[model samples]
Target: MLEEMVRPDVVVGGYRIEKKLGAGGFGKVFLAWRDGSPCALKFIHLESVGEWGWRELFIMLRHEFPNVVKLLSHFKWPEEKPEYLVLVMEYVPGVTLYQWARDKNPCARELVEKLLPLARALKAIHAKEVKHRDLKGDNVLVREADGAPVLVDFGAGTMPGAPRVTGALAPANLRYRSPEAVAFFLRENRKRGERYDYSVKDELYALGVILYVLVTDVYPFNGPDDELMAEIRAGKPKPPHVRNSRVPPALSNLCLRLLAKAQARVPDAEALCEALEELLEEAKADPHRWEMVLCYGWTADGRTTDDAPELVGHDSQAWLRRWIRQKPKRGRPPAPPVVAPAPREPPAPPVVAPASPEPPAPPTVAPAPAEPPTASTVPPLRTRVRRAAPVLMAVVGLAVVVGLGLAHVLGKFQPPPSTPNPGQSVLTSPVPAEFSPDGPTLWATHVHEVAPPWKPSEADAGAALSKADTPAPVTTVTLSSGTTHMKKKAPGSQAERAKKGNGSTGANVLLAVAAAANMACPGAQIRKEPAPQACPAGAVETMTRQLGLRLGERHGAGMPGEKQGSSEPVPVKAGPISVELAGDWDVGTDAMGRGGRTALPNGTHLTGQLCIGEKRVYGRITQAVTPTGDTFTVCMELIGQFDDERGLEIKSDGGAIKVHPRVEVKTVDRFE
Candidate 1:
């Protein structure tokens, strides 16, 4: 039934076959590419997959579960080969749990961390009322990209009470079977007529076995099937902590509860997931302790590699020495010439004052010769004053008597009286002629006017409007006695006046004009003014605004929201993407092939020039869906080898592309 073999470079159902994955009870699986993405294609013989099996597979595909294998699409070959059904699925790139455990030899913490996702995946499966009857290390995959565990191999699964596809009473893994499952098998084989039903509890027991193996790197119960069954029935398997002392008590207890003999004692998938999440949180909180238990073959004692001196940070002193050696020699920088400071100046000597000599006594003046006063020095001034004193006094007395008489004469002649004060004249002055006899007027005479009665008059009658002389016509009409009157004015008459017989006031003309403006000019203000007087027939003034931008154009030339000088290049939509990919090409299936789309974690879409080296090909990944999964393909015309780098180059026209980090490439490899 599996005889139709597909080789490398074969094209099947629009998928360019790259390599073989593996085979299972269902059929052969192959790694293929379609629509610029990588996918897994599985070929199942319609005869071997009976009605029940197909129905169960369909049910599984219809359900969506996280961390579980997804089915993308399915189709039956119509003409060329009608017996085969093709299923395209997500191509998961990672390693099996068996290989992961063996290669990594994970500690208790790492084992729990990796297995939590698988447990949660089981929870998702169970939530859909489906059971993975066969749960084992080989059915679980650990994604190399992020250590996430993906649950797979749902061929042995079905909804509760559904008939079995293969008609097998039980799975072959006896060491991992629960006690009740083994008891049921023994009863059926020994002719005991007791009926047995499989429950999620049995699957939980299988999960416990997988968890035990992942943590201890050994089966919980091993040896021949008979012996293993006896051990399982006896419920004598050692606690996970006993096998691995490093296992936390909480984790060990949870594992033991899963392996409980009583069906009611086992925890459901939700409880198991919760317990694992708590355990994971505890492990992450003190990562150092977990790291000690879970070294990835980096340290001899399983301790953190960071603690090893050999693996410590680079030596700055060594780097400095190498840098110094590499530098050009300039005579050792001349030793930077040792500069000595100048010597200190000596202190000045202390100053002292000299003794001052006693001041010499002033020499006595010499006596002048005793010569008698001659005729030139004749009479002393004192003798002259005494002789003139009596004559001067008698003259002074005569002059005093004459001054008294003159003073008496001058005193008698006084000035005439001055004019009267101006204050008295002001009190006697009369009011000016311009002064008003009465007080000023009041507010009633201004702004407030009584409305007048209307009276018809000659001016109110239709008068000849002189087009040449009058720009505005009188609109208001005067009416008296509440009577209407009509009178025609002479031809060409312009001036208007009320008829004296009517006792009416002349009509008043009031012109009220309303204007509306609508205009918009980019970068300019719109102002509305009255139209010109000469404008005819409601014509509006046309304005030429100062425009800052051209017609139908924006102010700036750059794309919206993009800065002028930012370093990030604008993403081009629907651009061409050139790819360089190389890896093994084979044809089979079951997640063994490696070449596919460079899928980034978290389902991110990537495009543009992508260069995928062989190391990027981890393994085949499967995401479950219906009909077919994500399709990817590479054309032969675009395939070529890169001489410098070890990869095949493929130039593609991606209608639109987004770059992702899944594909590793040098800076120069990108060509938009």
Candidate 2:
């Protein structure tokens, strides 16, 4: 049976346990107080006592890292009931990167900026002959006070020359292993005698994987152990841009290089940091090119602030209320007024009432003088006609003069109606001549039939498969919100489709013209009539149904490991991602740079879809230069359809003839 959780007032290692914050592999983490200050106490079960535990304690005690969790003190109980080991460490009052990413997956630039500090932390650990074998998102905490990232959890840590504390046969630790490390582990296991040595490269590789996940919101490789091993043997994985195209080529290339074969990858953590700093400089080089990319940071914490009064006993609710709250002041209520006896003379004065309620005297009445007939009552008819005659003549003459002047001005100023220019007509069309202004379209037919399968690392996957072990939280980040503003395309940008007479563009246009000229409705034809102004909603629905069916036939409905209708709105939080519009622009990215779809400071998700991998896919798209002046943030939702061949091609006569019909684009980001 699991050990009972310690209640408030329960003291361990001179610290009072406040509450169980969370449970980790070797023990439970609790919020505790020591010397009346908040601290974290991790209690390891006696059964978990082993060489690895002792070594982790040793590593933490001997060194300190600015970006790593600090160990304040540790103790073990031998004679105490329910024997246990307790470690007191600094309480990180910040949200885990795993939690932060759930709603606000950082883009490439943002992720790099945040991970740079972690890379330096790794360097520090490496310099001291230590390796944080488990460096996943959960192990990293961003300080709430500042956006600083701190690495935690040393359960799987090891020193360069220390004895192998973990068994070689353990498979769970292989998830983030470098290729060489994996090879060494396998070789040693096969021999049943040799040691599986880990090097700096192995840890660096894991850091690279973390970077990749942060940028793309997915693992670089996935599947069963054998499959992942095969990929490692291949010595190369798909680049980051393959999944997230917005990733700058330089950054993508750097991420790929970091994941290169053991010896080929960057030599050490210090070098990696230097490389990252250079990339950071490059990303922030151009001020005018930058745009705001909202990420997530601290929100709230379970622990109280330093100045908050501590609750002392078992009555948590009542004690907490009294501890932090002040007692209302009870001032001396006003003294009761002293009653004074009325004087005897005053009583006699009340009886001395005045007499003489005599009859009233006759009021003097004066006859009212006759009021003179006031000229204000009305003017005589003759006087009124005389006053109006001159005014009427003056008004008529003014009207006549003004009309003549206007006629003359119109005659002199009128110009002929300008004839429409051919070029103007070509440019005035709503649809572009090309489908994609950037370049050739990656047609659905030509693209891969299925997206590459992805899964958590073997270590993560194995831990997940086991019910006995409580897996560490591993949250995948995404764009937090569904609603996004639609920005107009920049001037001179190509139309949404191909240009007229430009091969595919022209062919599509011809098909549309023919369809307009030939058939007016489904299974019916009209000789000549103004184009239907509004198609019934029912008809549009039918068309959409048909289109979905055809697309389903052409391409599968969903990708592997993905579910239909699985997208849901994530809650927005304050602190970052709230922004203001520039003078010229009506909207801009969040100024604080700390929100995404999941952590919007303040806004409702009106409507939209958050899609992974498709950077350009958006129901609505807003491109704005942020205050950073180097990066352009694209706020988008994946919902509305683009004007493509699939959209233009609608069959009415059972594919007997081609038909190009006008398709009205759907309005996006709308709330009823």
Candidate 3:
């Protein structure tokens, strides 16, 4: 969210743009201060989305829902820059329910008790006209302040009584939506020419699911896409008691009622709250049942501290039947076990004539009680003992099973340490980005790496200018160029130049550098000639070198600086020659021992500067280098008697290497 902070162009309503707080599909929310008190500001994103926020705000204007995140004020973005549609609203500062759940995971007696408040808070939200389309753990922000949870992100949708958010994105909760909502939303966006309406029952149903998860830590329905949806919509959910016998029948019945698909099965939020309050009161009175519900729980992944039974099986059917058929509960005497008259004892005495007429089937005697039991018709000690024995044994087995399951879950299910590995890891950092109502601005965690000159230095200028020489036209070799008139020639060099008129000596120097460079920096190409004309607008080269290279003229090699004494645009040309450099070319050095810049093969001279930006750079690049094709360093500098200021500009053709420095390079036309 930090990434979203930007100064808005215009302030909306009375709130000045402070910084963006959070944002979503509809618009961005800002942390704003008014009259010296902090208030949240929400701005619409686009006109379409803004309309929805407008509608929702209108519907909920004065109504207040305690558990919901507060909505402060509304406004229209001041400008019509398609770029930004913004909004500002209340700022919520509580931890999300997901985080709370994670902290309190591995539900136990204490944790389950903690969940009751969250369940109630959800109940409150359902009471409000708003349906928190999303009821997932993350959507529920739980702050222990005042010992209650708060729901936030009162988001976008065509809420029950409200129209779509004029500026809202969309209101849909993927994780905890009810079956009907899920079907309605998934079925089609529009039906019968009207948009589908998400109902309030959906929220209540979601509330029931929340309770279910709180108790069991598992969704009643489980499976893959088609399978999971089918599971949610299909069969009867098992009672909570089935998962944890600690859950009393009363609570289990409540769960079943809420879970029932029949719309009337579960009451509305208000009624549900009343029922829950009663159940909770009862639970308080009965601690044993409460303990059991708390101790055993489930996760959607089938994790349970109690024996988890998938009730859709034969044994489950038998058990359910047995439970149903248990002799009418204690107080009700099962309609007096019908008794028939006792047969005559004489029939028994006639048993000796058993052989006679099959003894008349023993006269069908209905035996009389040997002894009249005290008030109760208790079964014999033996019969009673036998029946009670299995139940006691079953109880003992269940205890053992519960203990083992608890050990397995609690023993191994400790929270894993926070260390990410390749499989689930992505290179992520809090991208200094945040949500803004006016639209997001690009924010960087760090500045981009670049090359720039902070100081003006001859070495720097030369380095910038003397980029690699161009690929010369395939032609014959010749050289031409001119020198400034105002130089006090060095005696020995002057004598040397005069000794060899028209600089046959300079030509010799060129050939020598080219030859040595081939073997020295053999990989390096040295032009055996000089440039004939000026390069394009953005490029620059030395006049002497330009004329000497003769790369400009289309026709022929006019002459070398054969007319050195002349100051005319010396027509020039060069014969077929490959690029080469001297073996001992003095490379420029930086504050560090060595620099990457290499001196131009002696005869080459600085013609002019290239304008990169506000500055003119001397290393007017002649051409790009090979492979990745970026400008290589060059050696170029204008000669003057003494104090002349030099500046440089850097630039690129805007490709992979889009950035460069501002070197002050001067331009020249056909120079002699």
Candidate 4:
């Protein structure tokens, strides 16, 4: 499987395949260069990776970057052959924490001090909207140039509102996943067709594990996957410092607090980074030990004893053998002939290279044309022939009729369905219901649920994913204050938090919205500097697509191999925003041409539109501003709607783009 992924021509997209960097069960990762920049190329085994799982990731953050693993391009060429999704990302030349810890086996004081930046980098990522769900030593890579650890592998990461299944996320992820993450990862109400949505705490918790490992140089809890999963599931991981006594009490306390199944105990990654920063400052004051988290077996005493042999020989092996013999006090077993095997050389592969072009003439011995077989002359049947003559005639007639029918049917053909996702609502974004004299209006555009493994594909799934033809479906949702309510919850999902709480008091702090924000997406509210119009009036028209993000922790779609294992997401939804407003907006998604736009129903329109295939979004209201202007105080807000799709978006008051280019097709930003 890994060999098939060793592409000789293209990496996915147009990036050239260079060399294989690493291989794992799910697929192989390659170090590649594209457009004169280096990026990590992650491939997926076609048989095991699910189509939707890959689509969801493509929809969310395939190309967005800076903090997240930027998806520069994706692979599509091997469509007809045994296919693989080649994901090209910013080539980060760094040592995985596993490699780092191993290289330094016992981490030095200098190495420990170097970890401050790693935490800071993670904080920076949290500031952006991405989290590293798989935060094991292997996933946390330290840049060789700066010694900063960047989180990679979002196969298990989630934008807020993404699904979290029990088996989808790795058990290692569970080790570092926060309490909110734990609760989300282990849902009690899945029987009611409910799945826990991943939250921000997922990243926070993983950050905690990273911090613990960084400080102590040992996994917070180490064991087999199932055993560790059970321990984490059963809350058996001892406080990080307990494994290493030299670990600072404050650091230990923080690690314990992070492991605590309490929201108040474990805060968000930002807050955790602050606390760890303080702890790291203290650890720097006095550095005595090194951390070797993933590597073990080499003991501190063994080094000194091992050195003794260099100066003075010690044959304890012979002494032990003499003690074991005992018969007639026999001295050594005749010193078994030390016949060491000779070193073998690695074999070289054979190669053939021709210097000149060969002539088109080959030694061809053509066989003579085959002679036609002579028809055998037979005697014609006469009258009063066999008694079975009528049956034979009937059989011949039936054969002729069947052959004719087969020919007629074979001549005709029918085209396959264009869009597989029909009937079932394949909503790109929710169309908010209007508020009336009654209670409130809430009309949600539901996601078409994944059908059985053998079910026919959805028409829209085909159309939305199709690059050949069929325009993607688009929707215009009214963005009134009412439509800005928090995302929905899976059915009967309260049991997880309810298990720890008094039912009425709501100790489910992890269940809060903050826990599961899209780790890699732009926020729901726009954040432009110098105070952008007081966060907008009525409802802030923020834009995001239904990417495969779970914000904090991602649940499994199914088992590994059947789905991508925490490395990449597949494109499931994409769209941009179109609106008219005075406030400035910033948008981000896990896709290209996937931005947002905003425009008031009848007032000045501002669209936060994302070009679905471009993975770029920009703009604010067309305001009269200069370097010296925008000082006057004026405010006017109007209700509007947002239109979007996985690839395109459009929304405005009335004028058409054809009628007024300036009024409609204004160049906000080309953030290439």
Candidate 5:
């Protein structure tokens, strides 16, 4: 059904469908041609567009304003099924307000010029007791032909007598909700059934958000949903001038007043329009200051100079003028022609001449004639000295070598013995007093026969350790086998000497020797303490129960008689379904889906981003069309490989399912 609605060259009512324009949570919009004039055809499922929605359309038809998009006609589609409602309206060809600001880099005055008409448009609509509930940057368009702002997308609008459709709170973007509305929602959310009355103040707050984003390129209160809600309820956003100094003080103050929590503090639509007009007049008085680029490097203090080096030989002013006059070409421009150098001519062959020979003349000798003394006959003094210098140096070198050899032969040179530094003591091996060639050595004799194991008195040990060569302090532990083991004390130990009067000097020394032996001998093993015993079963069970309770509390589960949060999945019929992106996709653009069946029937829409790498479609299903042609809101992630036989799939708690593809996807970066 969505495919039939979006197919190009197909006649829908009187207008012919050209292509899809864009998609939102409720429906898909298409650019259609009627009598050679282009118009927008919005196709929304009948069930999703409530009775109040159609009434809002009637209100749009009744009230006409230059800044508001004009509604041409409305009708229900498919006489047999009658599942979708189509609204044909004048198409405003342009980029969104956000995109316009990004490209044109409008100044504070230019922004006021653009937003003034929107404020007046709001005033006109409000005169009839109608409120455009969903006002955002994306909802406002900057007309390409005349640079006029056109307010569009009044699907969430309501009149005084309109029945309630959106539950509890107004239908609006969370980022644009007023602080009072948020505070009311937080306070009343605990009640079983409560509703927050949407008012003019909330609409003005949304306008303030749009202004803040335009000036600073960021949301005033930004974070995760919960944190953002909390901030909207109680937090005070930073003023626009503080975030971006280029913003005018008057504009900044007005934006803050519009976003004030108290409803009385915010100006009505008509007052807001007057305020914008005053600001516009003030901006016109000082053209130079008001016309400076807002988002560029210019600041309130002064222009910010770039630290990067400028391109050599580039004249930016000339280039800008040339660009304005020249029409833009699509895709990458053709690379400059690369010309191969002309083949070099081979070098001309060397000229040759025929050999000419004549008989050699007899050798002739002539008497020398007296001539002036020349450089050839006698060299300069410097040249003569340079020529004789090498021979003289050779003789001197030979004499020096002979004298050194004679001195060495006479024992005049000898190397000095190595000696320790002044503060260092020389180490030497001490022979055991019991060791003798005629008797058994210490290692071969009985263990007790080695001069009673020669123990060092505490005084002697202290004196020996006082030297700089003392090893790190060690602790001796006596084991059950009557063997003592020594280990280095932990670092940062305050005691430098052993405990007084322990009288275990011999054991300590012996333990130190054993420890050194153990380190030096890799194969040696010192007994390690036994492994820790396993915990009792009762203790293990108790820990497990406590851990489960903590985890249950953290996850908001496992407690008896507690109701689950609204976000929990609800049961839905499971079956195979096919879907594809609702419109053309490209990198750095948002992508929406439109096809489904059975579990998610035809006309179901998805919202997501079209990323570059892997060419996969990523997003979630925001609204689902039922098999009976009804629609309901849903949150499920849509993920799958692009162009694969399995197609794209929606990952839900129900199960993974596929959506068959129908059309080839493409994108356009520029247009005529």
Candidate 6:
């Protein structure tokens, strides 16, 4: 019930809560302000605040490093209930390391300049016999005011006398676990009682993983849990330069050294700081090589290159916008505006005289003639010509039509034949031979005289003239008989059997051949060839089989009615699966969906939500999660209803409610 009291405008002790910043497995952190300065207030339930809570408070109060967050005050809230323990600390206003690198696109030299302070902070903490077991990108903050690095979140830290707060393995992200730690876990899982100790080398390896992602914009080993573990044990990741060419060789080597598999090969905190300092000095000597930004191809003039590599987990548009805004402007600055001297004041006009007992009207002066248009205002001669071209063409076309009509009425014009003569030669110039399935064929080169005009049966002068005005004759070509000839088929032979088997196939083949011929020589007439003959017994079947094989090679192999390279999805339905809630979940609030061992596969992620109806509550599956742990975004819809064992219970936080109910889920449609 204490969760209901955590919200904006609620004062815990002396600080007023502004908004929730983030939440973890144990508690939630909120941004709050007291007097005039802002601070972070972390609220933890008494039940969940075990030894780790006290451990964090002890480390924060004892430490005085400049690069670490300082603890201010702490107290248990609400004397009556006393359900939450609120800790107030100084708030660092900035983004996480991952967000900073993505927006800034820093080069190797700038990256080292920022990360050097983090190494020194680690050294300072290690000197006091304290170990920060979890060291990932999220734990480091780039301060908004000074650009200095500050380490935060010490919930998993410990000293010499700290109590054990975890099971066999320490609390850390799975992706940042070192190879040796993973091997130890695998070897000791079957033992009755065994634990793997988290050491300095493991912390350094986690830092290396952060550096690796900053340079390449992708995880070192990414896949399912099983495959990821296997690769971490034995696989070697590619160097940073291999993934992103802009990474400097020195920086890549440093990352590799920090991630060495052997514990002794990795450097300690002090040695790592020394190495970073040396790299910084070397960067000053070769500025050009070390100043290129990693994971993005950007030009000096604030433009992205065409050959830029694809970004994995960064927003391309947002990054490009930041680059454009932060890059220095090039070219010359504008000259100062010119100012002309003030003109001399003209002498006062002579005194005006009165006439007819009234003031004389001022003499009217004619307005100056308007200035002639300048070259900039007038259209160019070429533009004028372009605008009039279509009108000129239309006039010429009308004149030609009228002249032709006049000539036809006077019996002085004659049109060419619509079809060429059989014995005429149309090829005046040499051209390559036409292509045919059998072989190449040449055109005949003989000429013939034109035939006389046709005579009309009735004496209709208009009809005779219309017939004489036909279109021009088309160009014709002839094929050699011997090259394209096929044996004639006997009556009722194999040709009849082939036609009966599949008549559409033969027709389609002829159409395809005709289309090819037309495309080869446009606007030319094609003569009809002789009919093809039938093949011998078993020959047709062999040709059909060979044709099908060729088609299958081009378009994937399948039957006549089947589609290639695709399959229909099968609908999946699960019934009344029980899921446990980690924290108080309310209606319309999305949370990670989990089910019993037999309901869903491991690693599958389902985004779940609850919606209130008039009579019952509905459960919605907003994302699609397959049995193999593949996730896809889909349209949101209600899939099933919740059991009526427990209804909605309103909390005082806002318009949200909490409830525990069993749900049934079914997939409505497959993702695209």
Best-matching candidate per TM-score: 6
Q: Summarize candidate 6's per-residue lDDT along 1-672 as a digit string, tens digits.
A: 232366678888988877766544345678899998999987755544445667787787787776988889988777676766777877999987866875687888988998789988888888888888777776788999999988987777888777667556665655577888778766634465576777888888888888877766655664333344566676376676665566788888888887778554456888889889999999999998788775332221122111122222334332121211111111121222344445655656657556545455565555554443332322222222233334333332353465523222323222222332221112121111221122100110000010001111010111101111101110111110101101123356332222232211101112112112222222122122212222222222221221111111111111111112333211111111112111111111235533211111221223333334333333333332221212222222222233222222222224322222222233323211
lDDT of each: 0.40, 0.42, 0.37, 0.35, 0.46, 0.46
TM-score of each: 0.42, 0.44, 0.39, 0.40, 0.49, 0.51
Where is model 1 more than 4 Å wrong at Cα? Answer: 1-4, 49-53, 78-81, 160-172, 188-196, 284-288, 294-672
After superposing candidate 4 on the true structure, give the runs of residues whose Cα lies further than 4 Å from its correct spot: 1-14, 24-26, 33-37, 45-67, 79-82, 105-115, 121-129, 160-174, 177-190, 215-218, 222-230, 233-236, 287-672
Candidate 6's TM-score: 0.51
Q: Report backbone clashes per prediction.
A: 45, 24, 96, 99, 3, 0
TM-score of model 1 (CA atoms)? 0.42
Q: Which ten residues in a row have the lowest lDDT in candidate 1?
A: 509-518
Residues 510-628 of candidate 2 have per-residue lDDT tens digits of: 11211121222122222221121222122222212211111111111111111223422222111011111111111122677332111111111111111112112112212111111
lDDT (10s digit) by residue, model 5, range 302-361:
211111111123443222111111111111212223444556566556455568555454
What's model 3's TM-score? 0.39
What lDDT is reached at residue 537 by model 4?
A: 22
**Across residues 395-443, which tens digit of lDDT does each residue of candidate 1 receive?**
3234336552223332332223333221111111111222231211110
Flag regions of model 5 displaced more than 4 Å: 50-52, 188-191, 297-672
Which candidate would rank higher by TM-score, 2 or 6?
A: 6
